[model samples]
Target chain A: MRLELVKRPQHSALFSAVSPFIALALTMIAGAIMFSLLGKNPLDALYYYFIDPLRETWSLHELAVKAAPLILIAVGLSVCFLSNNWNIGAEGQFIAGAIAGGILPVVFPHVQNVMVLPLMLVMGIAGGAAYAAVPALLKARFNTNEILTSLMLVYVAQLFLDWLVRGPWRDPGGMNFPETRDFHPYAVLPELMPSAGRANWGIVFALVAALILWFVLRRTLKGFEIRVLGQSPRAGRFAGFSASRMVMVSFLISGGLAGLAGISEVAGTIGQLQPSISPGYGFTAIIVAFLGRLNPLGIVAAGFVLALSYLGGEAAQISIGLSDKAARAFQGMLLFFVLGCDTLIHYRIRLAHSAPSKRTDVPQPSEPAEVA
Target chain B: MLESILITIATAATPLLIAAIGELVVERSGVLNLGVEGMMVMGAVTGFGVTVTTGSPWLGVLAAVLVGAAFSLLFGFLTLTLVTNQVATGLALTLLGLGVSGMIGEAFIGMPGIKLGSIAIPILSDLPYVGRFLFRQDPLFYVSILLVAGVAWFLFYTRAGLTLRSVGDNHDSAHALGISVIAVRYGAVAFGGACAGLAGAYLSLVYTPQWIENMTAGRGWIALALVVFASWRPWRVLAGAYLFGAVSIGQLHAQAIGVSVPSQFLSALPYLATIAVLVLISRNRRLTMVNTPACLGRPFVPAR
Candidate 1:
């Protein structure tokens, strides 16, 4: 008789990849029930969300438009996660970037040079990287909890940006609305193939960023250092790779990319800075980074998938009776289920009877089980 | 104006203090419980539900503690039984709690809060300068302070407390000493859950008295950080909680004072100060490591 509890075989290669897929399938099934309860047709509701809008050219561009920030943020976050640094303030960095970049155009409305837009882009990224540096510095110097510090800063950044639009940056002529002056034409991201619709330069930046990150993560010495650091800080120190330095580098990179995404979204799509800009893309990027397994190439795909949820959520809000918050719940459910399924990846479950009498009632396994 | 601000600070700090001290126990037992926000929100919802259903506010508080503990079991299962990463599981628990509570509390929106009357002491509460400070409070405020003191003593002075500290320092050694590691953690985590629930219930029944989505906001996260600021000491946690509460409520007061500072800058006060404090205290790596629970947030599976 086997001494230890025997696990049923589920660690086959098929189940490894199939687990995330199964989790996704379960999420959809659960969501259908939620929709039906909310008085929406499950089939048509699902079709309207995942298909109808995506069939058009304009909607395709809209997908890219929304996915740009998600992709950029997730890609940068992947690097930070790999380096074992938890930078939870990317949302704040994105807002900071928007404020910094958006401010440039409002302040320099008169300047229409060949490089004005490029200068603003730099300013945007720099702003994000600087804001990110605060948490990194604290983590590196004092061993403070980066997770809390970074997350808390999100509120501060949101308030800071909100203050700006409501105060010094408010468009004096805009009839008491809480928004800034319209970004100058030059500062706005030029549409790629104007006929393709909302497809702006942000998508290009996202793709390029993904490519570079994928290459760096797969090929470079620094990438290896980051991997080592995340896996074992003890080993990293033994290998002489400074965990503190990696913290600073990863935070800056992630924050900078998120910032670029912010500036692009505001100037490119919204055209003016408002009190509310992002729909929690920075926070959602955490899901993307994990979903993609912290791989840059995988992040590109996860970004699109998450973007669909956001777009679909909006669609459901209009089509179904679901409130804005219910849609958010749906998205959170997807994340929860996905994380739950990942549990089986490392550990296999087993069932065994403590009492010997139970073994006589049930047939034993045909052979010793081969799990993980 | 000063009295009003002081009252607000006291009121604000009560919840933060309660939540922080609860988290402090969880961390002291070497379990980093980040599901505070979720637990608090659920407590707020259930507490409000119970208060509205029954006329007594005390029942609402009890309801919160139960709900918080129940919600915490979700976190406990993932981190303990499944042995997943505590931080990731904590985040998941928060998101799940938010979704579930928001869903359940949707119907309770706009119901009036059952307000609790202040319990005035004979001479102290009626005193000119010190009455409000010493005697005028909802019973929960004083209970929370007692909790802090009780928790501090339990952690530092008791045999069970000694066992908890030993378990936190090294699970293997504690197990060697025959102090069931998982059992102690389960007890501490449950206790933390109860505390978090009480804090959340306090928000719904005592302070705001209305059900809202994500009303706890980031106070839970602030409480977690305050644990670090307090450096694992219960008394220090009390001080940290009030400090954060002061800055948070103080911002509104500062804005109300007609301070010329932009409302945004004033709003940023609490968060900015928290980050600054984190930077200041955490910069000393040695101090951070020494006081930080050695096995905090790591799952312990009995490796037979």
Candidate 2:
């Protein structure tokens, strides 16, 4: 008669595996509610929004074009996020990389060699890493908030590009517009299958990078060190791994990858450095990284799914008169729902002032942990 | 020239100072609410809508505080009650805030703002240099200064602030010492939200006297940077905000003076200044480790 029933949170390895699926389900349910609020037929709208677009060959290529950078950036970001070193300035790095990578093509316009393209790629990666180094140095040296440093640096990078496009990088012959000269034919990335739309070697790079990162994070000594550094700096220190050094290295790697993505973008698709080259791919990749739980392979899959939403958003916009802004709102909604569900997974909910007077009865039972 | 630049700097500093000081408090109490942008935009829209409806600037400010605080409560609920990752949750809140604010703000695009009037001083207004410098400014500017001073006092002098700081520095230890870490964080978050709202309201009602899409445009992010530059001190936040505001408005002065740099480069000035200042201040690890909130951006989950 005195037996007490204990209420404990359920923890299974399977739960971790299913979290993203649950989050996606929640997102769909929320999307349905939003659609109904807008007076649209939820199922029909959903079908057309996601499926109708995929049936198109052109749309498939566009999805690849969009997902290419996202996958590349998110893969790199997984490394940083897993190490617990946030580099929110990937957007800046991306911008800088584009400027740097595209510089050769725009400046030389006549460089007609295979080696030129490879050199441009290297330059782009270096450019992004250099830009990223600003925050990384400040972080490693002064203990500045990397999130802010990196973010603030984004505007600087952006304005610098704007300045370049309108000034030195401006095409003198191309009628007063703020864009770089067209990229050389040699600079362009060859299509994968010769006719797969925008699907090119960039996707291949993303996949390869994801695999390498996955291997490095899951099955390597450096990976183990990064995990330890993120989880506990004191422990990392005891293990003789310098936190600042890791911070620098992680930032360089992340920035360099983002740079590579930026160059790949300019060379692969648009073939020029245009203002607003990315639709916030660097920022969106943050969501992709977290949504896939920071696993490289998981991020690769997550990148495609998120890319679908972007494609589907455009589809809905054109068909149902939904604005591009609304599509952005939908993306934001997806991120929000995923975050909300993530909370549910990590912590169980409790009803306050209800039956069963336990610790969960009161409010704010779940709170943040110490930095350590 | 100096007078105009000084005025521009002061005007520019108002909203940012409000936000940075507010973030200082939020960070002090163990939360990194990156949703400042979202809260500010929501405040801007809510404030604009209220001002348009009631024709009262004061009510607009009040509306902003309410909306911002309400939005911030979402952050509190998630990190405090939901035990979510603080960084991820904060990012989500910012994105959600931006989307929702943008949606709500669509109605107010291109609307004219209600301009706030200044208090005319008698003697000080008549003086040459000191007159314009010390007197003849709007009530909000003065209030913002007082708010900074008040915040500085409250944070350092009051016992309540001690508890808040204790909670931010080490919530678990404070919890063991009989402090409600959850409640303190809630208070800090709400306060931060209100401040962000005030910053937003200032934008609509005073800064430009109109509502536009994404007008805050990284200003919230700038305010976040200012907090780091200020080293979590209220007075330092005021100084940092003014410095940044000066940098923002300096481009105008430089352009007017016909500086050789391109306008785009001039626009990049404030961002460059922010990076430079962050580097200067953050390089001192011992100082940073001491000044920065021990639990800044960390989520706390109580054991069962």
RMSD for each of the candidates: 5.2, 3.6
**What DockQ score does model 2 reach against the true complex?**
0.45
Write candidate 1's Cα lDDT for A128-228 as tens digits. Answer: 99889988887777677788888888998898888788888899888989998898788888999787788899989999999999988889988899888
| lDDT string, candidate 2, A101-191, tens digits | 8878888888788888889889989999998888888777777778877987788888888878888889888898989888878988878
Q: Among these predicted structures, which one has the highest DockQ?
A: 2
Question: How would you encode candidate 2's per-residue C-alpha lDDT over B177-228 as one tens digit per residue?
Answer: 9787888999999999999998998888888888887778788888988888
Please state how well chain A of candidate 2 matches the true chain A, as a TM-score.
0.91
lDDT of each: 0.80, 0.81
Q: In model 2, which residue pairs have backbone atoms overlapping below 3 Å?
A: A142-B282, A142-B283, A367-B299, A367-B300, A367-B301, A368-B299, A368-B300, A369-B299, A369-B300, B113-B209
Query: Candidate 1: which stretches are off by over 4 Å?
Result: A1-16, A32-53, A352-372, B1-5, B53-56, B99-110, B121-124
Candidate 2 displacement at residue A167 in angstroms: 1.2
Q: Candidate 2: where is the Cα deviation over 4 Å?
A: A1-11, A35-45, A193-196, A352-372, B53-56, B121-135
